[model samples]
Target: MAHDHAHNAPPSETAMRVKALETLLTEKGLLDPAAIDALVETYETKIGPRNGAKVVARAWTDPDYKARLLEDGSAAIAELGFSGVQGEDMIVVENTDEVHNMVVCTLCSCYPWPTLGLPPIWFKSAPYRARSVIDPRGVLAEFGVELSDDVEIRVWDSNAELRYLVLPQRPAGTDELSEDELAALVTRDSMIGTALAEAPAG
Candidate 1:
């Protein structure tokens, strides 16, 4: 009975790399190299972005739900049954006709991981983290989301335990759609106030 080796390469690379590192650790007589590898794998692969999408989508479809979410985000999200680990005390900021909001973890990368998943490559960079608060309008403009000066901008600074998500304005032409269909209009960044969901075409 021949075993399937082709199905083994990508995962094998990590095992191979770990073994190489483990050999060095063993030579120095370290006890837990394998444990370290396990931790890395558990966090990197098992945890991701789907949770963030769920919350965003839910907010898009339910106005009453959205009101609850904005009033007490952590509790409202917990009501959806998606809270813990990377997301606990979550705050939702609503973007509206009068004001536009955006979130930034200026001190460090504090995010609602249980909701949004891993941060995008650009977000983890220094330039974006720095410029988002100091020049939010400029940062948004780069992403093609322009705003009028009268639309007051409020930037939330995320910290270690608290997380923020944006409640994007519902897309136009979606009033006639079903709840599930409207949910599809929400995007992670849009919910976080960086962008607006694209309107459904007529």
Candidate 2:
């Protein structure tokens, strides 16, 4: 069954309120727009999903590192120097042929900021928070991920104390790819379990 999902849903009320407050503050000369842009850039580029991508790439190439990561997500991730704030307590979930893992914050939008950066608007929406748990498979389908009936779907609920990151399965034709090359295939949504790692280009 195909679902008509709006991937670009409008910002939630909270986001609108925050934007309004920022505008008001900017108008009052209290908040520097350049500073805000710099901060967003830092998270969006430098310290964002790239950090998680590196971690995933390391795990993909090194079995020992992958074992440690699966055993102690926080410590293993800290080795890569991505830790602080919402990412203090992390749990790495592996997605295999038999099982697919999806993460959601049922109570609030608790995310691994150091790894995933800012949460997407849909992640904080009432519909996603509620529906992700109630209908995980449907949510995956909405995200354009289709799994076979033989595959098991596991939905993880993230909270203030613990956050989950999905270590997506590596693409089949990436055997000769370097760690950096492999990292390039990892995307933010894949780590968040909303999508799969990008396949290598021809």
Worst 10 residues of 1 by lDDT: 1-10
Best by TM-score: 2
Q: Model 1's lDDT to the true fold?
A: 0.77
- lDDT, residue 60, model 2: 100
Which parts of model 2 have CA positions greater than 4 angstroms off?
1-41
TM-scores of all candidate predictions against the true structure = 0.76, 0.81
Displacement of residue 21 (Cα, Å) in model 1 is: 6.3
lDDT of 2 at 48: 77
- Residue range with the least summed lDDT across 10 consecutive positions in model 2: 1-10
Superposing all C-alpha atoms, what RMSD in Å does each candidate have to the true structure?
A: 5.5, 7.3
What is the TM-score (0 to 1) of candidate 2? Answer: 0.81
